[model samples]
Target: MILIRARVEAVLEPGRRTEVRVPVLLIASDRRWLELLPSQRARLKGRFGTPRSADLLAAVVVVRGPPSVLGPPSPLQRAAETVRARLRRSVDRLPADQRGVLPGMVVGDTSRIDPDLAEVFRTAGLTHLLVVSGANLAIVIGAVLGLCRFAGLGRRRAPPVAVLAVLAFVVVARPEPSVLRATVMGLIGLLALFTGRRRQGLPALAAAVLLLVLIDPTLARSYGFALSVLATGGLLVLAPPWRERLRRRLPGPLADALAVAAAAQVAVAPVLVMLSGEVGVVSVAANLLAAPAVAPATLLGALGAVTALVSLTLARLVVWPAGLAVAWVVWIARTAARLPYATIPWKGGGLGAVALLAAAVVAVLILRSRRLRLVAVAAMAGVLIAVVGLRLLAPGWPPPGWALVACDVGQGDALALAAGPGRAVVVDTGPDPRLVEGCLERLAIRDVPLLVLTHPHADHVDGVAGVRSHRAVHAVLTTPRGPGREARFTSGLVVRQALTGQRWSVGDLTLSVLGPLSAGPRLAPGDDGTTVNDASVVLVARRPGFSALLAGDVEADAQRALAGSVPAVQVIKVPHHGSRSQDPAFLAAAHASVALISVGRDNDYGHPAPSTVDRLRSLGSRVHRTDQEGDVAVVRTTGGLSVVPRR
Candidate 1:
């Protein structure tokens, strides 16, 4: 699919006749539309729809067959697109991750970035590196100013060169609100530098903000714009004082780096929390660790893009060092993201912002006192040591002797039945990739002997990339019916039809597919997919004294069909997330010691229906809902089976 920004030249209606310049998102399947450039007009045949709350566009246009070119793009846009294409080609031979990252770091072209790596970048809080920001422009302007100095140009003459560099960088990055904000901030810095007055920085910043906001009032609502302004303000208003304090005890370079990272993180923390609903505990460290390579990568990438215009060979030569730099940055992001507790969940929205600001105030006030500062440091150090000690010596996650784990993936099913150390049978990889990936990582699951996708529903298979990102899956099994486009990520994998009476063994565990006695029926793609839910692959896993029936989202009809085959077990994954359409006799036949229900909190669909919970309870089974607990695990104990809830 191609997403294009276009204006409404005319609205198609019974008698309407007008032209409007409103922004719209055009979704089209024709590959030819991908060639369209910014500022070019297009005659689109589509149905106009209202934009969703989260969409940035004013309207959504679903285009038919193809687009008709209305006009050619301006010369500047054409040149920029050509330069971007060349920059992309410059890193054609680099490592896969580096090739994707270099262009993104240089010109904000992220089309080539792997989805898994993009998620890793988000988790590591290194997402900023992929986008064009004040940092990128600052590096470019700094390099240009240094070059001017080396060329014997005085400071007075350097500002003009820096201005040219900023404008050029803006064009390459696309003149979006965020890029424009960065450009203005870069010019403000150059203004301060050319005038030889450090104090003018704040006034220049204020003037720049005032002018930019006046020019585009919508920027005030842009998150990227806010982050860019906050980061630049942090560098100017907070970094100098913090650096002076750090220099007293550390080397100049280390102090400067630490100060800049901490200041930016501090300034953006509240907004970041509001945006992501999580606070990056490791972002400052990750940024500082990756900072050294960013400049070389940015500068080299820019050089490569420029040189590509002359010779592709020269561009490749310049980008070779850039690959190494990008590799280092990617490594840092992956390593940092792999750390447990890399980010801590925080509230989102207005309350979260106020809470963060209040906490910052308290921290600052305490740091102002020498005695209080020492006490605070000691307290933080003690807490950190205690948490680390617990994680290493007695990590509560993935409890030992675990037979099965139901990952809390918010209204979806992602379960792991242990096969051996760092190996398991993963089933129904939840709705969100990151959520499921985090669950697998916490379990230290490195190998999957078998992956069972119950059905093609998005909640069950949208997270395929996360599961396969850094692990080895020997094989995959799914229902007889093919999955839809939502499960396209797994299309490359060879998937076998999971038939009734099929069996597989890995390590000490045995798995048997036990349901959908027939090939089942097919429904239109636009249907509610309840028939597909009934066609879910049902399996029962057994290991030593532990056994559990892994029921997919089968409703009552499928449950009744499998009633004769259902066997009594210690645990049962409540079908359809315990929707009201459950078969009581089928549930009662399980005779389980534990009933694990996976569902989301405050979900639109009232899952884990109270009736289902009561029915399971009436059967003398212990019920555990993932919405209440973070991850629910069933562990074998000497006495009997015990449930461990990770909250």
Candidate 2:
């Protein structure tokens, strides 16, 4: 592979950047990628996509070598990198929670953070700390000002000291685009404090916006930059009344903390909802829990960074309390993230943002009402109780006697056969690993004793990563390898060739594999895939009374070949995503009451061909397309078999 070095830049498109990933340009190199970081250079080799979705490049290799820096960075950038490196080293001696979280709390470095723990922050809504918001800057500067006052420094002396502290913080936190954005907001807040006119901060906010945009015209287009400004405005305009109202009952310090967190969350809720397409239900409480630790962590962390310039030993000492504080914050994120109803999925886009904004307004209005406040409080208590009660009493998942679930994996097939609590027999993985993983998470499936891939097609087996991400599998079952058609997936899984008459029983339920009319279990090599569809692994699952036939993506000939044994199943996974090339006779022989077509929405192939659906329906089979419905599950109720869709 040829390698070329280039500067890295964000994806040149709006609304595509996310906290978890970024699409970027490797300038000077010919690749356009989605996982590249901003403000850096890299050497990588990748292939550009062809036809539809062209221009997108997927990297196969990212070459690692010393970067060719033409010149040294500014003093501020140098100072920031130096302090950040020292801070990381000092905290490295701490436990994972502290080591991973302290630098993030202080300088917005999360490269060494754990993935599960990162997800915990997102679920609990503590992501802002890791992003380096004005909160970090304020904490550091406030601590300096407090010390100045304690030393009996005159008011005139304090402003300069605070200003110097802010400048120093900006340096030690890096002058990257994100840090620069946050620094501007921090300076605006300082202006308010220095002038003793909190209201003037509004004007300062506007000025900062104009000034930053003039210097970095691209700031006008950055969602992260916009969010930082919005959060700062929230602190100035909304936090005071919140503090006043909360102080009526809560202690002064605690009320202030809650006020600041609530203000920022409420202010940015619309934008965040639009970007993430979901609301973190536990965000308020999670932030409140982490609030007490933020100031101490930031202040002490900054102290530790400064101390490192003198002695590493003293730096470690200063970081101890900060590490403990961060540990507390990390604990809050992890515990609360795992709580029930921590995040509620929402439809994303302009409409979703508007809806969330309306709800936030209603909440504020209700809280403002004296008499209605009591009613609202009681109503909220009842709602919380009801939600917990329902989750405990009647869990929404693994509904009683749910036989199977056909995950909506977009143009591929993945069927989950229930075995026991948190366990399932997965049949076929979709085209993408992430999508399949999401389906498993929704099903709350954590164990897969068997993962059966019907054939070697990408759509049928590529999603192995999804399964690997979610749970461990006992064995991966597939057909014997063919020379040309057996799609290869690179994984460490032990492969078992599944052919005719292989059966497994679990708790009175029996799962049997019975097809691939090959002479033996060994696949014939030099076999081109003209008849590969006919060679799909067919599954028959029954639980004493009910049975379903899961036919992989077999076309007409394979369908006809397998039809003889497929008895009249109550549910059938229609072949080839309900393509046009299906056997009418085979459809009739299956005698399925409910036929499921796992196809993508608005797919280019026009899957579930009109003839296919018509043919199935003509055979008296109720047809359901995953494109129209979401995850379609087959349930055996007292009223007989019914198909349920969950979005």
Off by over 4 Å in 1: 1-19, 25-36, 40-56, 60-74, 115-124, 148-161, 188-199, 338-341, 370-378, 396-647
Question: Each model's C-alpha lDDT?
Answer: 0.85, 0.73
Model 2 misplacement above 4 A: 1-43, 48-85, 143-178, 187-199, 214-218, 245-251, 277-282, 306-314, 338-340, 343-347, 364-389, 396-423, 426-449, 452-474, 477-493, 496-647
TM-score of 1: 0.69
What is the Cα-based TM-score of model 2?
A: 0.62
lDDT of 1 by residue, 176-285 (tens): 76678778867877877888978466676777788899986667777778888888789888999999999999999999999999999998899988866678989999
Q: Once all C-alphas are superposed, what RMSD does model 1 give against the true structure?
A: 7.3
TM-score of each: 0.69, 0.62
Worst 10 residues of 1 by lDDT: 521-530
What C-alpha lDDT does candidate 2 achieve relative to the native structure? 0.73
Pairs of residues at least 3 apart in sequence or in different chains that clash in candidate 2: none
